[model samples]
Target: MQYVQRADRKIVGYEETEYDQNRRNSRDQGKKKFSRTMALILGVVLTLELMIMGAMLFHIDFHSADRIAMVFAFAVLYFGVVAGLTDK
Candidate 1:
């Protein structure tokens, strides 16, 4: 079977072989899986950040809270951007 696609205002037509289809599907699936994994990791990291912040609020050992918070914030921001791009 064949399909048509539009790119850069140009019309293109191509036929995908069985092997090509499987390869494409696997690559797409891998992106989805990686996005999910990143989401889970982001969630865990955020949770740790909250816990650490809460500990500092409760007057616990959080002398390095500033450094840790920055790390978690950047991690979440980076992963969030990656997830958003992959989902679309």
Candidate 2:
């Protein structure tokens, strides 16, 4: 049970059942897990992409076109994943 008071001095009582609280807690946990997982994924992907670009910039002997293509592919894939995540 909870009481909410308005600025006008009106009082309102609300009942929060245990089941409701548990369900809310579980939902929050799920969202946190999802966000963490997505963050990890994006971080790894971005790191790898940066490393590749850095290698290319330093003349690492990789074919220029191929390296650029790979970077572009990764960017597209990342955007797709982002779209999917945001769709939820």
Candidate 3:
């Protein structure tokens, strides 16, 4: 966290601001594992994603626009959300 100290409140002559760097930044927070909730979500999402991939890969009537739409929806919704899933 960063904090700035302003001593002068003048409208025309603004003094320099002091910043504190002792606190850690928000981005430097500790690691976050794939929680149980996320795991459950991943399981369901992965199952459907794999099924779609199999259908598309094996050329098993995966030509429908609906199928393509399913793929796009998964990418837009779940896959990106699970991108932070880590083994450790």
Candidate 3 per-residue C-alpha lDDT over 1-88 given as tens digits, one digit per residue, 9 for 90 to 100? 2244566753353443343232334345554566867776876777687767877787766565477786776666555445545344
Q: Residues 1-88, candidate 2, lDDT per residue (tens digit)?
A: 7799999999999899999899889988876434757765875677577657877788666564487776787677666666665455
Model 1 clash pairs are none
Scanning candidate 2 in windows of ten residues, the lowest lDDT window is 31-40
Off by over 4 Å in 1: 1-14, 33-60, 63-88
Best by TM-score: 3
Best by lDDT: 2
TM-scores for all candidates?
Answer: 0.30, 0.35, 0.35
Q: Which ten residues in a row have the lowest lDDT in candidate 1?
A: 31-40
| Candidates in descending TM-score order | 3, 2, 1
Model 3 regions more than 4 Å off: 1-24, 61-86
lDDT agreement with native, every candidate: 0.68, 0.71, 0.60
Model 1, C-alpha of 6: deviation from truth (Å) = 15
Higher-scoring candidate on TM-score, 1 or 3: 3
The C-alpha RMSD of each candidate to the native structure, in angstroms, is 9.1, 9.5, 11.1
Clashes of each: 0, 0, 0
